[model samples]
Target: MKIILDMMGGDNAPLSNLEGAAQAVKEYGVEIIGLGDEAACRKAAAEKNISLDGIQLVNCTENIEMCDEPARAVRTKKDSSIVVGLNMLKEGKGDAFVSAGSTGALHVGASLIVRTLRGVKRPALATIIPAKNKAYMLLDSGANVECRPEMLAAFAVMGSCYMARVEGRKNPTVALANNGAEESKGTPVLREAHQLLKTTPGINFVGNIEPRDVPNGDVDVVVCDGFTGNVILKLTEGVAKMILGMLKEMFMANVGSKLAYLLLRSGVADLKKKMDSEEYGGAPFLGARQPVIKAHGSSKAKAIKNAIRQAKICVDNDLCGTMQAALDELAAQSAGE
Candidate 1:
């Protein structure tokens, strides 16, 4: 499988992307087509002693900056890594597109260039968030800030398909993120969405899920408007970081604490791994015609490599095809009704 990578898109730019591409090629045996300055990438790879075997470099001069307006930059920066890589995915030159760039730019580029699937109004940004025993997929995680009722219902279906097809979850339970577990607890949009999700065939809609209960691993898919989902995603990250920091400081406080840390070092390491965002790679822009992974802008080689692995998994599982089928079935049911 071929994965198109935006080499010049992230904070670390071409170097980290290059390293990740090399690792992916070696470990996954997948072809990498990097969109960036070919000569500069090759020089950097040489300096770092990283092999670019089985990887092809496409020359891209411009790069979309984080400050650039999403739609405007995507339209004007024709030669940019994001634009070029997305166009390649649209043209079927690659199996998936992976970028650690501006989330807005990647979302805009994917929606405009790759386009959404049939019957899909807007694409949702779906990410695997680590929970108690099982990780749940959160959709609209900063994609569309404001979502319609039917849009949330669509997210439910897409999220369900994603958890099942890519993550191998069976009959994944779907829930709407709400202030309370009650069906009428959220805004009008969410209340209507709740009703819609209850009838969204092929999905195990389990009514509403309070944000607090989300971490309990009871639900497999959590659907929400981008605004709320973004808040949840960021808050979860912040709390995890803060807690980990507090633990580190506590462990280093005194000799007694140090001894306690030594006793729990293995468990602490496991907890750190569980909380690491890098483990899940990146969020997938669901509803797009092709798989588009939105890695963290500050992603290093390990995260980028895992993101590429996610893209491969999405393609291998035919995620888009499965989603389209589910959507078509839903459309048919709606039309019949």
Candidate 2:
């Protein structure tokens, strides 16, 4: 499968992206289309000794900076890497698009260029959150800030399809993120969504899940509006980092503590790996007509490679098609009601 990557989009632009593309090519045996300054990409690849034999460079004249307004930048910068890369996806030049660029710009461009799946109201971002038993899918991570009951119901459907098709989870349990575990808890929108999901066929809707239970990984899919999902994702990341920092300071406090740390070093490393968001590569913008992955802005080479892998899985499993079928069933059910 051919993957289009935004080479000039992230903080580690060009270099990290090129390195990741080289690794993906060598390891995954996939063709990578690099969208950026062709000269710069070539120079960086040479300096880093990254083989570009499997990469095709598409020269882009402009780049959309992180600070630029999302919609405006996409509209005005026709030749920018983000716009051009997305256009390529829209035109079916590539199977999927991966970018570590501005989240806003990516969402805007995908919505306008690639378009959303049929019967989908708005595309939602789904990220994998590391949990106790295993990682789980968190939907609406930061796409649409506000949403209706039906929109959230759609998120649950898409999240379920992704977890099953891509993550290999069978009949994943779906849960709504709420203040309490009770069905009657949460705002009117969530309450309505809970009721809707309870009746939605195909999904294994498991009652509401409080934010605290999320880390335990009891549920396979957690659905919420973009605002709540973003808050939960950021808070979890911050807490994990703070705890790890505290552990490091304690481990180096004295000779005895240092010895103790030596004994637990392996376990600590495992913990850190589990908490690292980069391990999952990036979040996918579900409901889009084609696969579009949003890697972290500061993603390193490894993270970018993982993102490419994730996109490949999406394409291989026909994620968008599965979501469309699920959504069509929901629409038909609603019409019958």
Candidate 3:
């Protein structure tokens, strides 16, 4: 399978992307179409002693900057890596697209170029968050800030299909991110969403799930509006960092503490690995006609490589097709009612 990669998107651009692309090609045996300034990419790879074997290069003269307006940049910057790569996906030149570019620009380009499933009102940015014993999918993580009740219901369906097909979870339990577990909690939209999700076909809706319950691995999918979901995502990341920092400080306090750390060093390493965002690679823009993965803007070689792996998994599992069928079913149910 061919994966379209935006080689100049992230902070460690060109070099990191090239190294990651090489690693992905070697490990996954998939062809990669690298998009960016061909000359720059070649120079960077040569300096880094990285081989570009098994990868194709596409020369894109322009790049969408993080400061640029998302919609305008997508429309006018025809030669940009983000726009060109997404166009390639739309034309079926590749099975999926991976980018660590401006999130806004990527989202706009994917929606306008690749388009969403026929009946999908809005595509959601879905990310996997590591919990106590399991990692759960969180939707609308930072896409649509405000959402309708029906949108949340659709997110539930899309999230469920994603977890089941890509993550190998079966009949994944889904819940609404709410203030309390009570049915009557949350704003009017969330309450309405809870009711709709209860009867939404293709998903195992498990009523309301408080934010506190999320880290306990209580649900497979957590559905919320973009505003709420983004808050949860950022807050969770901050907490993990703070805890790890505290642990490091405590371990280095004195000779006695240092010795103690040696005994628990392996366990700490495991914990760090479990909470690392790089493990998941990137977040998929679910509902897009083709897979569009948004890697962290600051991603390095390891993160970029994993992001490529993620794109491959989504394509192999037919993520878009699965989501389309689920959305069609939901639409039919709505019509019947």
lDDT of each: 0.91, 0.92, 0.92
> What's the TM-score of each model vs. the native?
0.98, 0.98, 0.98
User: Residues 1-337, candidate 1, lDDT per residue (tens digit)?
Assistant: 9999999878887899998889999999999999988899989999999998988999998978899999999999999999999999989999999999989988888889999998888789998899898889999999899999888888889999999888888889998999998887978888888888888789999888998898887899999999999998999989988989999999999999999999999999999888888888899999998999999878899999999999999999999999999999888887888
lDDT of 3 by residue, 175-196 (tens): 9999998899999998899899
Instruction: Give the range where candidate 3 is weakest over 10 consecutive residues by summed lDDT.
Output: 115-124
TM-score of model number 1: 0.98
Q: Give lDDT: candidate 2, residue 100.
A: 97
Q: Which stretches of candidate 3 lie over 4 Å from their true place?
A: none
Select the stronger candidate by lDDT from 1 and 2.
2
Clashing pairs in 1: none
- State the lDDT of candidate 2 residue by residue for 1-337, as single tens digits: 9999999978999999999888999989999999999999999888888899899999999999989999999999999988999999989999999999999999999899999998787789899999998899999998899989999889999999999999899989999999998888999999999999998877999999998899999889999999999998999988988988999999999999999999998999898898888889999999899999999989999999999999999999999988999999999998999
Candidate RMSDs in Å, in order, are 1.0, 1.0, 1.0
Error of 3 at 330 (Å): 0.6
